[model samples]
Target: MNAYRAKPLRYPWPPVLYAAAMLAAVSLGRLAPISVAQSQGLIPWLAGGALIVVAVSLDIWAMKTLIERQTAVLPHRCSSHLVTCGPFRYTRNPTYLGYTIMMVGFGLIMLNPWFFILASASVALTTAFAIRNEELHLLSRFGFEFERYCRATSRWI
Candidate 1:
């Protein structure tokens, strides 16, 4: 799995693709004949924003558990742990899970199908990329331990 090992990513592709899809969905929704009420401005937005924050907190907690479990820990960007506890036991990437939940919350706040679609796309793409990169790193680092974890826990929940 050396070929798939995590390395410097092609930066803009992931961000650009995700942004473009999100924007396009939003643009289409706006252009189409839909009577969207502009009145729902603050409350829903606040609620959704709160949800996003909670998700992020959960992610932080999960990551912390992984950090505690790993022999050598690093910062977020350089984390080398193959965490399989906490929320990670349910979904391989709780960080991504937080992002997904946040996106959904944002969609609810926006009350726009476009935002929802974008959130979905973002989750799907991020999950694919994360799994690929993380798998390679885990295979290289933890070997059988990582494999056992993978067998026990799902990639996503």
Candidate 2:
């Protein structure tokens, strides 16, 4: 799908959907026991912080590369270049991966098992929608070169 030709909600809805779920969990989820919450302490905070940092950095890195490469970031826009450098070498969809990791990190921070459930839903939505559509678009646009990239990189790490 050429990104410019695609509508907003049709292409990038995961972030909004995840945010809604996160908000719902925060407001409606049963808080874990005080003991449980307390015990899930510094480590979770540290780890979650680390994951968020990584996630944001990966997104920055990938977006920078895409911009430098003169490639379109929008799913329905024309892709002028296929970026294989930086984080793209590792994951086909670093932006999507970043969002997934962010969900996990947010879950860790919240200490609510429901947040983890939200993260799982995030992953499932990401896979079923974002990645699937992007993969098909990339494959159709880039053809064999995209296939080689796919062969070399995992979808997510």
Candidate 3:
């Protein structure tokens, strides 16, 4: 019998980390504001709005796919099945991608340089703390099927 179980992540949830990062960025920006542009223009508004929409749509699609497949949505839980349809076809980590995109969108909308800087840091932390363990667990559980999916799909898009 397989003895391995997907262990809960030692770190906080990715969303929490993202939120903290955003907060920190905002605080830092207020203390030392670095202007990206002279004015809050229409271009930033349109671009940011479009990005937010895409991020939300991707997240919903990914979550729905996971639910339909009867797999765990939270990273801490073990996946019951390998999901390869919907947004999963494009990115192995669609949810994380969504989070990152959302952060970027907010950064643009807020015109905060610190948001862009900390967004990169947030991705790095998430990858190190979350994705590494998830990949290992999925490999241990799903074996070659997960490997094939990894080969076919990008981690982020």
Candidate 4:
């Protein structure tokens, strides 16, 4: 008899992509600064701050849920089971969504157009490298349960 063992992910692409995008945005902004508006006021700061708070809240909720479920939070590690509670009930990729939202909030706060652009790129890269791979692993491991969850929940909100 052959026993099937799930293989772990090769790289933690979500955080890495987000970090790289942020670095690129900062570097590009420093080289040639692009402001959202010439006369930036309190509006941007308020909106950015609100978004940051929401993103942080969502991330914390998701992480807490993962911990409570006793599942692996790291991208490279294999999750023990399908998580469909708390934030997972809404979005399949809450952590990645939170990262994207935080990047957008930072873009607004810094008044840097590059951050916005790089944030989109980060999503694309993360989807291609991280999310897709994670989905495959989950489907292989959890099969029907994962499929049911995917059908019910959106990838990102």
Q: Name the regions of candidate 1 deviating beyond 4 angstroms.
A: 1-50, 66-79
Q: State the weakest 10-residue window (summed lDDT) of model 2.
A: 1-10
Cα lDDT of model 1 by residue, 1-157, tens digit: 3643443233424445555665666687779624556655588788788988987897788757876887222221334666776777787666666666766676667676666767777778765765566566667767898889888887767
| Model 3: how far residue 59 lies from native, Å | 0.8
Q: What TM-score quantifies how close candidate 4 is to the native fold? A: 0.92
Per-residue C-alpha lDDT of model 4 across residues 8-93, encoded as one tens digit per residue: 46777678889889999999999988755554578887888899999999999999999999998988887897899999999998
| Whole-model lDDT, model 1 | 0.65
Q: Give the per-residue lDDT of model 3 (tens digit) for 1-157.
A: 4333555365448989988998998899899998665555688878888999998999999999999999988887878888999999999999999988988898888888888899899899988888888888788888999999999988887
TM of each candidate vs. truth: 0.67, 0.83, 0.92, 0.92
Deviation in angstroms for 16 in model 3? 0.7
| Clashing residue pair totals per candidate (backbone < 3 A) | 0, 7, 0, 0
Task: Report the C-alpha displacement of residue 51, candidate 4, in angstroms.
Answer: 0.8
Q: Write the per-residue lDDT of candidate 2 for residues 5-67, one digit (tens) a residue.
A: 233225557667778877766765555432244544589888888999998998899889899
